[model samples]
Target: MAHPLELAEPNVIDEELIRNCITTVEEISIAEDKKKEMKTETELHDIKAVSFSFQNILRIDNLNGLFSLVKLQLDNNIIEKIENIGHLVNLEWLDLSFNNIQNIQGLDTLTKLTDLSLFNNRIEELKNLKTLQNLNCLSVGNNLIRDVVHAITYLRPFRKLKMLNMAGNPCHKDPEYHMRIVAHLRDIVYVDYRLVDPEKVQQAREQYQEDLFEILEEEKKQAEDEKKAEDHQQWLDTLSEANLSGVDTLLKVMLDEDPEQGKLHHLSFWLEIIDEIQHEFKGMSKDFIDNTLNANKAKYAEKERFIDALRSSRQKSDGDSIALVGKFDLKKKKLMRQLEDLREDETVKKLRELQDLNTELNDDLLELGLRQMEADDQIVSDFERRYGDLVNAFVEAAQNGFFAKIRDLENAFHTRAVTMATDELEHFAAGQLEDVTDEAQIFLGDKDIVFASLNASHDAHLGIIDGLEDQIVTKERKTFNTLVAEARAESHTRDRKRITEIATVTARNNKEIVELIQSEQEGWNR
Candidate 1:
């Protein structure tokens, strides 16, 4: 079977279909003389990506014309020099590994390059990479680089880098290599050729930073929230009146003392006072009405009695008309005298006094009614003021500062998270490199060159063939483990969030019901 690299690489020299595909309008990547004799009208447009890696083994410099290219891969070839790669103004990725290049002066013009890998080459110095301010990923491994590390003056320009590999080089043998690399290249993710995945490291670091920021923000938010809550509670308590309980107690006392008021009875103690005054007035008025009716009745009774007496006198003096007349006249005189005495009785005098008292009580009852109306009005006004204060307190509690604090906390968390991610990536790079170096030293002690390994330490390294097989197996296992952990964490988080939401909703609903009941009770009492 062919080597994997050969099977994977594009065959640039054969096939008429491939030649036809390379039109002038389209992207055309051909070997040394493959497209030299082709005849066709190109119609390709929007050609932004192209790769010619390990092809055109005999071509020296034929990539100067592809100005529209953005990516070019020319690694694992016999290119002897680095030239004209800077002519492509839009180039972002350039890989020129496994070449005979010994210098690197022609890459200054590719200012747009963010990723550049020149591994397995004869280049000794990285002197021309100063202009690559936008460069993010760099690979300069498998080279005779003795003092290249010392020549790196600035690393601030490549602030966006997330991955870096510098294995298969002598720099890994430096005693303080890990420390120095971590101290300076802070954003690198991978350093040595191993399963040196830094995502977990970055995630842990970010999580820690996020937690720190969240704690600080939460503290600030909590403080503000507590202050606002306290203020709100104070206002609410004030509006409700710290004396509300006392007021309630007093109201209860009043209800107990004056049960008729609690019963909503129309006639209470005050009404009874009015009723007493009305009674007095009615008593006096009754005397006047009764006196008139009694006097008329008494006069009528006297007239009847006198008439009967006269008739009786006449009957006794039968046939003596003159005697009868004298007797009748004498009786009339007696009755007249009795009538005058009856009119001067004390009962009539007492009736006159009762009338006077009744009139005074009626006047007093009117005055009391007016006073009660005024008192009712004042009580209603007091109730309205207290209710308004309660509303104002609730409004104050819902101020904008509460949400602002939450937003600040969120922003601080994000910033700290990104910073921590960068730090962890740096650590991962150094750690992976050091671990691999140590593993090579331990397992391949007498070997001229240490190859691959199962783990990142020398003790984990097997024979070359066994190490490679173990690497494949371990990578698969590690990937599966990471997936499992992520899934479990996600499930736990979801469950917790769901439970909390349900509890919060239930609690809020219960609180609302309680408040409503209390309010209703207050209204009923008032």
Candidate 2:
């Protein structure tokens, strides 16, 4: 063999160095292939996000294979008919603004979508978006949303919705449309990019609380007032009924008495009041007492005049008053003589006619008197029959009963008028009980207290009722004011939400612009 060292070195050392080099190259190649495959999987199967905005990018059809995509943005694109976008099952965000979309059917199957923007599109109707329950922001501005109310209704599934933009649309032309939108839309704070003020919202809340409180207070007051009015009216009704019953009882008692007794009792009752007044007047101011006494005296004088006239007429007409009888006999004789003269002489025809006329007049007058007598007799008998006992009782009372018993007292007062101050005043005040008090006294006091109690009690009761009514009116006004304030507050809230959404969109567009510029710069550098 060749020298051992030389042969071994030539065969083993160089070959081993070459084999190690090949093995190293092979390992490097394998690692490179694995890395390439990993990168390919990451790019094709693990797409986390995608955005294409405000660029000359014409289409998105090539992205259909991105099944693992989570977000897709194609804003400011001149695309049309957002078709086949439902193929993106994993997509959560989709923005295809500045397009020619006419309907919202493309977003129907995007159940997991939380954000979707289709601004500056030609969409006239929003349909088939009922499944987007997780949507938070939806921008469909610069489009023809004719029936925005219907669109909002259809989008009820999106309970988490926070932002909506429909500016530059015809629907905003309605004066109350935005306010109603704020009312119906859940969680939306603004409309057409307008924002609400926080201070205003707090004020509105305070106003609403005040309103609610006012309403409650008012209702309570109204209830109390009604109750009080009912009680007062019932009390008055009861008093009126009692007065009617008392009057009826008094009338019956008077009717059962003899007419003279009835008249005497009535006069005595009035006379007692007069005596009381006279007694009270000794201690009272002279002028007031004198005026009251004079008025009563005038009333009594009129009653006496009426009684005197009736008595005079009755006495004059009592029987045997016969001027009419005397005249009738005289006329009868004259007529008889004239008839005799007419029978003897034919030239006495006029006299005979006159006699006959006079006879007829006499007969008529006699018949009339006979009827009057019969009527008078019937009247006297009927009067005695119906009221004979009443007359007797009256006569006895006037001559020897209650009047007789009080007559001595009156005579004593008249005789001792120089020493009669205390007794009369007491009597006058006591007699006023029936004329004044209706219900039992709630409190015991003197005459002044009684008078003050009646008047002051009425005023106090009415005051309470009036206070309740005022409370009711105040509360009602507060409630209405609160509602109006809430409405305006809600509108502002919606406006804020809309403004925030628009700002966010604008910020995103700006960011996209930066990214596009960087990408362009990087491409240029490459």
Candidate 3:
């Protein structure tokens, strides 16, 4: 079996395999010179994306022909250093995560890269990525990054970076790590897996602002102190030179007079000493006077400088005050003009007129509403009167018709009962006489029995018909009542709808009037 890390037949260039591995391809033609003759060479143009992730590849090589490649995924590999990828000029996305890479290098040409993933790598410092200006997303999590500030400084050139993943790195373990990173890289929207909100960024800025100001102030003070020390050293050098010359002259004069004197020389020496003392005293008095004059001159010079500074400051203040007064006068004129305009505004005058007219209009509308209500009441009363009359007439007509129908049915039933009873009695008499020896006695007894049976049957039929008529009358009365109730509900709905329409119209008119007044006021303001 072949080694798992090696590609089968590594030396062979399988065009078909390359095409299969590539996600997208384009075709193009290139000019080629063959045997001193120019020919157009057609070839598979370029691969757009290639994924060899987890392929156990040892090195990133043999990809020189993919000039237009935009994305390459080579994560989980044994590659050590980032190399051999400088030719991918159009590459925008690269994944080298989970690799043995210790340093980021050889990516100088891939300037179009917008996303780069070096997660789970041995890479330490964020370096050699300064040229990737278009980079927006970077994932270097689980790496060996230590100095957060150094990393921020290194990544500062990538101003468009919006997403950065630095989790599991040594730099991310610091206290307020997210704030530190956000404070430096304010353009980033996402750090690690956390979304950086505007409030956090603001808080970071506020938290660090005082520290930054203190640092700047300390630097300024250090510079000033250094300058003052330099000036003090120069002054000390000048004073030492003056004092050294004076001491040298006094020593020379004393040495020249000391050796020649004895006892009388001692007396002469004493007298010379007294005379020298007097001369020294006179010189001291003159030097004191000169020193006093110099001190006074220095004091006067300082006072003049102070006076000049005060005069300059006062002049500036006066100039600023004059400018402010000029501005105040201009603003006052403008305000006076605005006040005059407000006083003379035609819109305000029109508004007053409209207010007076509105009162009259409201009075007229109220009177019209009262008249409408009275008219509506009169109409309702007339409608009720008409409805009542119609109902009464319909009821009277229905009652008369129902009574006529009932009377006719009753008369018809009576006639039919009498006819049937008479026919039945005759048939019984005829049949009895045919079979009887005592015809007259038999006929009399059967006739009474037949008449009694017919009467009972007729009465039962009349009772059934009466019950059916009562049921029909009840059902008709219920149907009529239902119809009347429905009609009343419909009338009420129509009246309510009419009232709502009138109210809506009134409200709309009022809104329009208010809007007109507001528009007029706005126009005047403008």
TM-score of each: 0.31, 0.30, 0.36
Cα distance off (Å), candidate 2, residue 57:
4.8
Task: For model 3, name the residue pairs that clash.
Answer: none
Total clashes for model 1: 6
lDDT of 3 at 163: 96
Q: Write the per-residue lDDT of candidate 1 for residues 17-130, one digit (tens) a residue.
A: 323334332355666454544423322223345445556442345454557767667776666677755668788888788777788778888888988888988776667778
lDDT per residue, candidate 3, 1-526, as tens digits? 3344455322322454345445432223334434113112223345677667666666677677778788888877666778777988989989999877898999988899999999998888988888899999999999999888788767755789999999999988888778777876758999987888899888887887875466558769988999999997875564333221122133224324333222112111234443544454345434533443444454345436544543454355446534543554454355435544554365455444544544444444444444444444454454445444544443343344433443454455446545654664565557533432344334334655444544554454445434443543455455445644664565466546645654554455456546756776787688
Error of 2 at 198 (Å): 7.8
Top candidate on lDDT is 3
Q: Which regions in candidate 3 have their CA more than 4 angstroms from the true location? A: 1-17, 24-44, 210-526
Residue-pair clashes, model 3: 0
Error of 2 at 303 (Å): 99
Best candidate according to TM-score: 3
Candidate 2 structure, TM-score to reference: 0.30
Query: Which parts of model 2 are misplaced by more than 4 Å?
Result: 1-41, 55-59, 196-526
Question: All candidates: CA RMSD in angstroms?
Answer: 48.0, 47.2, 58.6
lDDT of 3: 0.59
